[model samples]
Target: MTKPKTQEPVITSTSELPTSEAKWVTLRKVNYTDQTGAARTWEVASRKTRAKSAGVDAVAMGNVILHPARAPATVVVIQYRPPLDAYTVEWPAGLIDEGESAEDAAVREFKEEIGYDCEVTSVSPVQAADPGMSDANMKLVMVEVKLGEEDGEELPVQRLEDGEHIQRVVVPLTELYQRLVEWSEGERKIVAAKLFHFAAGMEFARKEGKKYGL
Candidate 1:
């Protein structure tokens, strides 16, 4: 038996928009000052919102930082997130900061957060982590390398660059997992970052077992 052929999606042109050529009409230029104020509002413009069907929200560039441990019990790590009030425990991550590639940022975060220099071997596609929020986006990457010491001495403390606050610290994979389970603290831990820890830990455990000629 033969089945009917399906039709392909057709592309649309700008002529389909509310207006032929998109343009912003300045409704008013607003600038002012209030009591005890020297300067005030800057110019603003308003534009029609995109159709509800077309509006989409997302979060950008997120990764689970993984630091593989070699023959040691140290869950050693550093962290330097700011305000210290909201208590956000997450892997070194951000909104896919402009001008920086995801792979580049992932490498930089490893250095800044855990002081590890790793290269991105692969990356997952961008996806939303938050449905209720616009720009609730993130991506995961496979950062590869053999772990080593920082400054040839102590484990490097986690630090953030450009005052983009964060703290880095190594923790025992077991301990961290315990905390996550016991306290139900999801905010402090990025979903992707925790996964990275598990992956690295499992790999490390396997390697160590092989080292003992297991």
Candidate 2:
């Protein structure tokens, strides 16, 4: 089969966004008190699409797809992130629709972005996404996808929405950290903070475990 061609998106122009016209995000001048009771003000960018029923803004799926004949692997998404004007290596994630639970969002996003049906194994507590910059918070939902021998190694076709151009890469869990590092350097792609941290943490634990004979 032939592969489809893709081009890097071009930027036509840029301008400051007016707060009144902003739909997805907004700028805020926050006021607060420090540890010493000192008054302070800081500029911050905030998301305007957080659903009140969801509580948290989004969910990043920590996917583990197990094949009967092969080692367990995870799928990561490579998509163009306009803010950086470059592609990013990130977990399959998406905003929780109104009244949608984190688990449902994770499952839906995984199917849409990676074309896999997964079962939610666990869900993390609400955690900050970028505390220093935005008030965005998210949950890390651990999901497992079981593949039968008949399924083969090929991933299913993605069901992405319009305007979405994402590439999915499946990597063994043991090689995930190294792969992310190589992709970041070789492809000159930005690594999303949450994804990078998760990979780094796994690598760190593996190294410590070996050193401690764990």
Candidate 3:
């Protein structure tokens, strides 16, 4: 008699996986059938805030702040990211509060992280942070601010949260791309995608004499 072969289990749906307790984040495992209908399993890391939301998860916001001065400049922040165990250079960003819009969240984060009260000039469509791994989304807001002697006001002070430690870095508009390139080659440094995209648009606009949506 010939020996019989065992059939593999087919996964038709996803479910949450058991994980250790964490305050800000959680992990889940999903099971599904791929395009070829093969059973597959994947793990996802999600923000606890989104998981705990009553209805739909709130979108996050980031600001691309431009300071109009004798020499045009843009603002970014350097802060420690626990996951990477390194400092990340990113735009001012935060999650939208329950009753706030993306523009409102952008303004609040700008004040909290960079200490600047800026006028929001434009807001971009929502973009996924990482579709393959996370469901996080954020809108990039363009803010025009007058800094230094241009606005006739003193330097703004950061209003960071209790556990936050952020440092402001200003890059000259002309050198924004160059600085990004340098940072890309540096050690233990990660640049936010939104910042890179915004800077690239600005650079393109400068070369082509076309406005890239501010």
The best candidate by TM-score is: 2
Estimated TM-score for each candidate: 0.45, 0.93, 0.72
Which rank order by TM-score, best down to worst? 2, 3, 1
Better of 1 and 3 by TM-score: 3
Better of 1 and 2 by TM-score: 2
When summed lDDT is taken over every stretch of 10 residues in candidate 3, the lowest stretch is 51-60
| Predicted candidate 1 versus true structure: per-residue lDDT over 119-184, tens digit per residue | 677777765553332334456666654554432425565565553544344445445555534433
Candidate 1 CA-lDDT value: 0.46
**How far does residue 173 in candidate 1 sit from its true spot (Å)?**
3.5
Give the runs in model 1 whose Cα sits over 4 Å from its true position: 1-84, 148-153, 157-159, 162-165, 182-214
- Model 1: weakest 10-residue lDDT segment is 54-63
Q: State the local distance difference test value for candidate 3.
A: 0.69
What lDDT does each candidate get?
A: 0.46, 0.91, 0.69
Candidate 2, residues 1-214, lDDT tens digits: the string is 7856777787778899899999999999999999999999998988999989988999999999898889889999998888888899999999999989999999999999999889999999999988898898999999999998899878899998988999898899999999988888955498898999999989989989788776
Give the C-alpha miss distance for residue 137 in model 3, angstroms. 1.6
Tens digit per residue, CA lDDT, model 3, 1-214: 6834533223456555556756776888889999999999998877767523322233323434444445666777877776565667877777777766767777788878778787888877767778799767666677777555456334478887876877678767789877987887887778877678867877787876654443
